[model samples]
Target: MQRLSENPNTLLALYRISQAASSANTPRDAYIVIIEELQRLYDPHAAAICLINPNTSLLEIDYALGYPPNLPELAIHPGKGISGRAAFNGEPILCNDVETDPRYVKLIEGVRSKIAAPMIAGGQIIGALNVDRDHVDGFTEDDLDNLVHIANEASRVLQSVWRKRQLVMQSSQLNALIEVGQSIVSKFEIQSLWQTVTEAAHQLTGAGLCTLQLYESKEKKVSLQTVFPENLEFLDMVGDIAVTESLAGSAIRTKRQVEFSNITTPDYRDLHDVPHDSEVTSCLSTPMIYEGKVIGIINVFTRERHRFANSERRLLQAFASLAAVAAQNAELYSRVFNSEERLRKSERLTTLGLLSAEIAHEIRNPLTVIKLLFSSLDLQYPESDPRNKDKQVIREKIDHLEEIVSKVLSFGKAPEGIFTHWDIDDLIADTCLLVRHKMGQLKIDLRHHASSRKARVNGNKGQLQQVLLNLIINATDAMPKGGILTITTKVEQIERRSVVALYIEDTGSGIPENLVARIFDSFLTGKAEGTGLGLSIVKRILRSHHGDISVTDTSEHGTTMRIELPFVR
Candidate 1:
């Protein structure tokens, strides 16, 4: 220890090496600097830094100086050679007589003596620093001591650099995650959502190709849904994998990440679901878990044969979570829209029944008057006359008409509604939630303005919800691009009657002038796919509740629908 401190030149060399390693931006750069410094100070024929590869736990040369071209290709197992022995023991070795040492594994010819010292960081042996000479017994105890000090200093700087880089990379990954999450939420269509996730995984992992597979519990299989680049030619060759087979299947089964170091080998040839291409080498599969169940699998492939790091595994899993969220949101979107459609159909049927009943009652009174007049005008005629047969036919048809009217009246009778006092603002807010995702996906903004005074309405909750949904859906359709949807509620006096006025407005292309007058007329629609019953049913519901709806404003800028219902205190 005294000898190490006494040499001014040795101290200067160590200081320079430490500075070089510290100034490097990456671990690879620091490795090069440390190896070059070792060559300059010791003047050895060859100097190299061989670190333990996390994947193989072997001493593999990371940086070297003055070694053969093939030196980089060699990986020595721990406790096998001088450097390996140093790393294995976590100590320094001064092998002056190579011929006498049984542990030495010959690599470069004519190299007789070598010195190895383990590079320990955080109380663990990471690798070893090695310097070789061409003659036997060429290195001394003092040389070995200097080498050990240099190795320790290099290890400290290297570890600091590694940690800094890791932190920076992790920060980048986190920001990417935030962006990807936002993108995932904005994609309502399942295919677009799957494509977004696939591309994100590919970009984040830097993989050659990324594939997204969705798990179908009913089918008990995982099918390839989408792929990054969208141009991978081997898609036709890939097949659906059962939950019990393949790398992706294993991930789903275990709910854990599964890795294959090399998929080109004969053992993996039977994995029909994995893309078999020469350019593709390694594969990593992670399951997308949602609500404690596996929803799908995300598989990433690397072009070069490589072992994935712990950080990479964590990132892939994070992406899996994002993918799961996208899947969940898409499913929810489908369900909401489907439910809205079903409700619309139900409301249509109810309104149609009420209309039929009203028409039937109007015809029933006149038919009874006709029947009474005909009975009063009873006339007798000869049995052979055609007029007698005609009278009989008229009587028969009249009776048949009366019977048909009575049946229609019975079938069209309105069912008693479940009416209650409900806050208009709360109902509107709740209804908005159902279409919020759709609005977001279309880039539409929604603004709701609740009345300062409580605007309560006495009506069927389901009917009112149906009304709001109908108007909102129509507004969304009118805006094919994207715009703002505004909902406002206020209490006002109309013709001395207290009423609640609800306004649903959209910044969309307004209703055409030709259709404005009869927008509420059944089967009158401007839209290509419109059933034309939405607004008609809306009008019927409002009328039944003694309310009214009108187009208060319309232009190319937007449209406003005002629904006025009698206010209940």
Candidate 2:
């Protein structure tokens, strides 16, 4: 051993070990200097500084002078070997011959004496200072005492380094949570939200694979919603698993989290045969929940064996909760937005319908005067005269104009809702054929479906035709991007009276509930340039004919409009 020369040098060496913690620029550098000082004070054939691996809680030799060739492969749990026992109980051990002691685990091959002293800080044993010699009974009690003293000297430096590492880990976790929260809240689409959540999870945990498995309660099935960095073979095999079969599914079914520390082990990897599954060591799943109900599962995977910290699991739980809430809120907002838009549209159309009625009234007055003038003149002509034919054409034209004006003014009253024997199915077929060309250009598939015998109704053919045409046009406008339009005819009992019903179904944006109530009100229309009189007229004609119209159903998928006309007795 280096002659300490005097008690002053001995004191100086201990001081250096204590001061090295704050004096060195880095934790690694300080630890290196501390180990060197321990060896310099007590010369031994072999010496090493061991530290506890926090992840596994095992003693690992950080730096060793003489150990077995595969020393790095050795992991000593607390209280197992002489060094481990010293670390576990915070005591010092001086073995005169390690070969004679059962507690002394043989490491290096030779005649041996060993000494191990626990490194303690804040009343906790963190590791140990260990040394071995080639000669038997080489280390004395005084040497063991000196080793204990060295451990104490280095304790301050180790404590400082550990605390600093913990702080860094905490800062990273907090920042990750904040960024994820902002990303999820800003997303409105369900697919986009899933992507954000899964990608964030992969980045935060540094996992090899991350995924979202959504549970469809209606189907009682779990399916993968999102898989980040998508070429994982194990995930492909476990793509769709039943709740009773897989870890992620179990988490969803039970509304809890599940974890597997090493999935490649015989017990788990063999239970469910993951196809071509390789390289997965850890798996963790947290249920995505909102309002106390499980929606899906957030799964993370790692290639190296890993133990999930409680704080990390809690953070994932927080992320899943936020994702669920955000998705639910976006859906609710979409519905409310559609409803409000329809209500505003209805109000505007009603206002325009009132103005239209006034214009029709003024036009009717001028037409009556013209009719009287033609009658007062009493112009007569020969039957063969071409002028007589022209005069007759004028009369017919005026009468048609008169009919239109009357219909306009009596829009709600239905002044001309005359009943007649009308083949309803035939009428729909004709109208559909008329618009087939237009629908083709819009990429809409138009189909006419009829069941049972042809339905004949006691309704004005012209008026009913107008109503059907208006409904068809409105439905087409709803699907500007093109979709399926189905017209079906059937006879069914409505309140015990058999009525002929015409149903118009369109794969278009559904009507908002608020607007459905006022849909038939004059001047209310969905189209930007529509006068909104068509459905109002259709409602008037049907009501006058002892029939009615109603919306069968409407949603994001599409809308169905029903026209009911009482059958002729």
Candidate 3:
């Protein structure tokens, strides 16, 4: 190193570079100043400043002078060329004969000599300061020594800017984390919760897109839930990924965060087969965990191979934590609402049972008296007379009334029917026997079909029978002119659970559209003669037994009702 008194020009050059470094906004800008001074001092054919990328552990060209237009922005790894060797070895290299030197990789034509020195910071090489000449023996030992000292000064400036940037970024991260915390506590809907997380990540990192994926824990699969700026063309290619083979899955398995600077060329050998669109260049996936369990993953995507900063990682991790809690709370709220709905249905069943018993008792006494009087007068008329036929008709109507009264009496019984594992096919067969005769009277054809397999459901037999009976009665009423009535039973999967489905289809004029919605409401009737309590009571019974009924199909041609009961595995 030359003293300021011995070399006035060197002092002036140092002052200019130092002043520029102090005022520049970034390391790149400072490098521009430093390289300019080096060019004037050594009079080389080219000068370039390269910085080490911590993510890739390679030297990245930050700024260059006199380089050819065709030169790509190639990463310089350890021992690849002169610059790479200097940066990797943490030393200075001065080659007066470029063609003879093995470390020299040809760049500009006619360049015969070059000198490179490592930029060191915190006892490690961070980059290389490289200069090339067009003629042999163009540089001296003094020039190499001079560049090394200047490179050290440049490294100090880079370290300062890096530290300052980190401080600002960390501060921003803290604020973003606080916002995420607020959203977690307040939001409950699944869509809204994921939207908040993506929006927060986009804003925090200034990334163009952020994706949220949901994990189906039972199925052990992950699927893309939502993407920010929903207009990407790659949406069609997004598909479910198995937990064992995904970058997000690794994070979930380890319960940590994973990042990829270049997903097109992932570092992990296992990810070589992972198919991602070319538009996504860099990505980071963090597991959304709650209570030490992985819930899902929040992914941040960029269109370029960006070295994700520490602040970005921290912010995303914070988001994952908050998002996981929000998801958990939303699911818990859903389960709670479902439970409350069941409780309300149970309460409604109890009230209806009490009311039905009161009405049945009042109607039974008068019906009994009429039956006794009719029996006394039955032998008075001649067997061939029309009066005798009319008397028989009245007696037959009395018995139907008695049956209706008996059904009402049964309504007062427990809603949770005998809890037993019974074959649903057998139950349907027994109930069809009661309605088969009535269906024949109306000339309505009946068809029954069953699956080859048997599925048993646990429920009260009487309550389930009553439910089937009510639906059959409605089917007969719908087709007074005689249409086909079909009942089909099968075992299927619902929400990943085994279930038994009983389908009742009637080829009668479909229910009026206006009345279909309210058909299960108490006292809402389509017929002019009777109170509409049959279907309402059926709904209550099915619900009490942990089964449900829905109108699966309906039109002018017919109506189909489907009742599903959970089956034991």
Candidate 4:
């Protein structure tokens, strides 16, 4: 230390080296100056600075001065060369004889001496700065002291630059996270949001591939939600990495980020059956947590083994948080949309009910007066008189009008039925009785068949009656030209459970092919004066009973509607 301050020329050089080190924005720049100062002060023929490459676990010459252009860049393991020894021991070494010193590994063959000092900061030897001289006994103890001082200054500068770089990188990553967060929030559609998230993750990590795996907690399995490149062959390779088998799976199970630097190693390689062409050397997988449980994983893949810096991990974690929020929001939005649609349908049904009640009310009073007049005229005449035949014709016409009016009144009236252990066969009979008048008017032959097994289903006596009645009425309407109307009841077994089926078939003009799909939709009518609610109301009643009504067959010949109900235990 005293020799370093004794020489005026060496002192000035030390001062200049300190100034250059202080002004350097990075450790590499400061290291270059320190090596140059060592050459100027000691007159070395060759100088080089080697630093550790953490990824490969090898020392590499990051910056070198005064070495031949054709000379291979220095690369050595820890504790391998004279410089590696200084780096390994964290001390300064001045070897006076190149051939005699065990620490020296000759790079340029000649009789020479060498001085090497560790570039250490925070108690870790990052690498070493070394200078070589062609003359023997060229470097002195004083020169070693000055070189150590300059190496210390260089180490300090490098540490500062490294810290500054970390802060800058962190700032950039944070800005990217903010941008991704904003993008996810702005996208309301789930598919669009997923696309944005995948794209953002790829951009942030500079990864060759990005994938999101969505887990169905109830199913205890995950599915690939989205994969970038759409056709990337690595999907099968990386996608096969199970949540129970690989590092990604471990992260998902732990609800944290799992990083693998050396994917080619036996430990990690054994976990997945990756293909050679996948070339996935490094991986960072973060869990997507929602409601305090890991719901999925977001994985990023790089082409080369990477020591995922802390900043990169943090940025990815932030992005994962945003993805979770977006997923939850998208699910909620879908639910809200579905609820709103149900409310609208309910409102429309209520409006239709009210309008039907009003129309029935207006038509009932006038029809009652006509029925009273017809009855009086029939009483004033005798059945055997010559004029009775003409009077009978008038009476029959009045009765038909009354029957039509009664049907309209029944449609508007609230259902009423005495619940009983009634056979579905009997119910079909009652429904046929109601529609028998219309069937006669249309000249349609109505055939009814019942299951010999006596199948019974639990339901509202009156509502079920109404359902059958509406279906029969619609069936008759379909056959305006008087085709056969077939009503059949049978017991069926579905999924190893017994069910009762009621089928109604008509031979009238079948529903148009285009309108057939929506025939059961409310307010969808094919007739000029049809209310269009018959099939819709039938469907509603069947659904309320935990049953289903559907069109089983339709063609130009006819349409067949079937209703299925769970068998009563």
Best by TM-score: 1
Clashes of each: 0, 2, 2, 1
lDDT of 4 by residue, 413-452 (tens): 5443444456888878865655554465579999999897
Question: Model 1: how far is 145 from its true place, Å?
Answer: 1.1
TM-score: model 2 vs. ground truth = 0.58
Off by over 4 Å in 4: 7-22, 26-28, 68-73, 108-111, 229-242, 245-247, 266-276, 379-569
For all predicted structures, in order, the TM-scores are 0.78, 0.58, 0.56, 0.64
Worst 10 residues of 4 by lDDT: 269-278
| Candidate 3 vs 4: which has more lDDT | 3
lDDT per residue (tens digit) for residues 1-569 in model 3: 45434766656667777786458776667777887888778877898888787767777777788885543456767777899999888889999999999888776677888999999989988899998888998788878877887788778877887776677668777877787678665666778877777787777778767887777788888877677767345444566767776667877778888877777664543642233644777788888888888878887878877887766787788778878877876776665445435544654675677688879989999999989987876566788889888877888899999999999999687645358888888888876654554565579888889867887888888677767767877888889899999989889987888888989999989988998888788777888864567777778888887888889889989999999888865
Candidate 2, residues 153-210, lDDT tens digits: the string is 7777778765666567767878988888887876767788888889999988888888
Instruction: Return model 4's CA RMSD, one decimal.
Output: 19.5
TM-score of 4: 0.64
> Rank by TM-score, descending?
1, 4, 2, 3
